[model samples]
Target: MQAMQQQRQSAAPGALAAFARFVLCGGGVGVASSFAVAGLSSWMPWALANALITVVSTLLATELHARFTFGAGGRATWRQHGQSAGSAAAAYGVTCVAMFALQRFVEAPGAVVEQVVYLSASALAGVARFAVLRLVVFARNRSEGAATARPVCVPEGHVLTPAGAAGFCRAA
Candidate 1:
């Protein structure tokens, strides 16, 4: 039981640390973007304003996640950016739907109400986004962590290899 606990702790240490960094980096940008979206909404339709802010903030957050949150050790690649963008689009939809529901229930909802709804939606989406980013977008970061031990793929016909290890071999 102790050994199992230790292994679980070792595996989760990176995830817990990464989640803290993710909250700091992504939450900061989200707060800023919320204000920006609210401000921009005054000049244009709220949806348009939200779309603009979402794009810019998504870019900034992806960069921050790569450098600080996920410990990618460098700038995010185009592929990572694209994948992050996909997840952000879903988050955007979530926020928009929440806002729409607010509008439906309350006639001319006050700024405070709108912000409350928007931020609530954002928080919900953020959790899922963190999962997707950690498990898929920035998976390499976890695999590269020193605390984690990854199985090595042995070459075919290596003397040290067990018969069960054949599953790791590439199909010729």
Candidate 2:
């Protein structure tokens, strides 16, 4: 059916937009967190500083993805916060395991190599984070009652139809 095809087609653009936002926002968080960690490391153990920066940045990144990337309400509810926490925990576990494997087997002999390995692990974990955020954490539940409708954000100049979403330009 044409309607079914259109419906299927409509979601991809929004998903792509969300993915773009996720990558940009996540990269920004990573860069800022790294700088914070670098500064903090001079005053404390590297591990301690890294953990401190990561924790804050992870929470902020979750909120950004939920609000800006997925157009979920900017206000984070308890449920949303919990979901973000869960996603971050899962992502952290994956990242740690990947980094451990790389360190155990690879010839990462210098600071640069170690940083590259870390970044690669983080990037891989980020893919998982995006999946969880889209499918579970910030998903739009269509079955909710009218009274439970979420305050979705629609940027100016984008069209949101029943079959489509908040961050796309409609073709004339």
| Top candidate by TM-score | 1
Write the residue-wise lDDT of candidate 2 on 107-156 in tens digits: 65555665676677678878888888788876653123234544666677
Off by over 4 Å in 2: 1-13, 98-108, 141-172
Per residue, candidate 1 scores C-alpha lDDT tens digits across 19-68 of 99999999999999999999999999999999999999999999999877
- Model 1 residue runs over 4 Å out of place are 1-13, 144-172
Candidate 1 is scored at a TM of 0.76
Clashing residue pairs in candidate 2, if any? none
lDDT of each: 0.87, 0.69
What is the Cα-based lDDT of residue 33 in candidate 1? 92
Worst 10 residues of 1 by lDDT: 4-13
lDDT at 73 for candidate 1?
68
Candidate 1: lDDT over CA atoms?
0.87
